[model samples]
Target: MKKITSALVALGLGVALSASVQATSNDEAVAERIKAVGSVCIEGDDTCGGAAAAPAAASGPRSGADVYTAKCASCHAVGVAGAPKFGTSEWTDRAGKGMETLLANAINGINAMPPKGLCADCSDEELQASIQHMIDSAQ
Candidate 1:
């Protein structure tokens, strides 16, 4: 009976040791996986330090004539969509509406004319200069 009791105790200890060893190996495996997967991405990583900043504006504003010749002429010169032909009496009626009205119409669009006449990125002031070019041509 004494020998049987000793054998039982030794068996229980071995079982406990084996369970502890399995638990420790599981913990080690989890730790190894975390080390492999986790990372700290800083300045040099995939985000690449945010978007690049836009360049500064030009020293002075672009000229009205330049803006018109490049953008307005596409529609206005040929009277596309009933747009008054450049330098025609057709512009006289629109000119009669005054410069402020013309600038607003050019920037926001009116009748068959598109906003900025499809120059979407044009600033309100740039559209104003463009209107001035058409108005100047009519004179």
Candidate 2:
């Protein structure tokens, strides 16, 4: 009877150990399956994926009309937040400040406007052109 009881105890211990090992293996497999499959590539890095290269600038700076429509129209079109409306007298005072000051204000942001008019990626030339587009439209 004593030997039989000892055998039963050993068998129970073996089963528990086997179950614990199996659970650990399953947890590791699940973690491996859920791991991130891709990584971010910093600009200028050479090892990034082929399609991840920075977009080439267009053959020329984007047209002011294009830039304005894409970036400034939302605010300037309807004078949202006091933005000067295009094709109207609302910009006369701002235009009176001269193109230099207008460009500077648009680039650096003034009042409720954001720097570069919220077009962070716009080049200085592009911003200038966009401002000119607004001025032209207003006049």
Candidate 3:
């Protein structure tokens, strides 16, 4: 009877320890699942805890041909929706409007062409460069 009692106590203690370990593991799993996926840190906020994230590198303003190829080619390539076709007299005719008027038209949406001609990120100088590129192509 003494031996039987000792065995029962040991078994009960083992079961309780196993349950405690399992509960801790389960709690950890739950915590991991509920953790935040991402966090935003404003510049100079300092409260973000760790080191500040590095700013994105600047590659400088894109060339006219590069901007035109990426943004303007879609509509301008084939003159879709009345867009002036590249390498045509259409650009020459439009050139008569002068740089100021053309720049304004390009900056503001003109007819079917949207503002910046699909280049929302293009600066005024870059736009002028692209305009010159197309005009040059006409020759």
Candidate number achieving the greatest TM-score relative to the actual structure: 3
In model 3, how many backbone clashes occur?
0
Clashes per model (N, Cα, C within 3 A):
0, 0, 0
Q: Give the higher-lDDT candidate: 1 or 2.
A: 2
Stretches of candidate 3 exceeding 4 Å from the true structure: 1-58
84-109 in candidate 3: lDDT tens per residue? 99999999999999989999999997
List clashing residue pairs in candidate 3. none
The deviation in Å at residue 69 for candidate 2 is 0.1
Lowest lDDT 10-mer window, candidate 2? 49-58
Error of 2 at 125 (Å): 1.0
Q: lDDT for model 3, on a 0 to 1 scale?
A: 0.90
C-alpha local distance difference test of each model: 0.80, 0.89, 0.90
Give lDDT tens digits, candidate 2, residues 1-139: 9999999999999999999999999999999999899887887888885665768656778989999999999999999999999888777777899988888888999999999999998998998898888888866
Taking the tens digit of each residue's C-alpha lDDT, what string does model 1 give over 3-54?
Answer: 9999999999999999999999999999988785544446555564334332
Instruction: Order the candidate numbers by TM-score, best to worst.
Output: 3, 2, 1
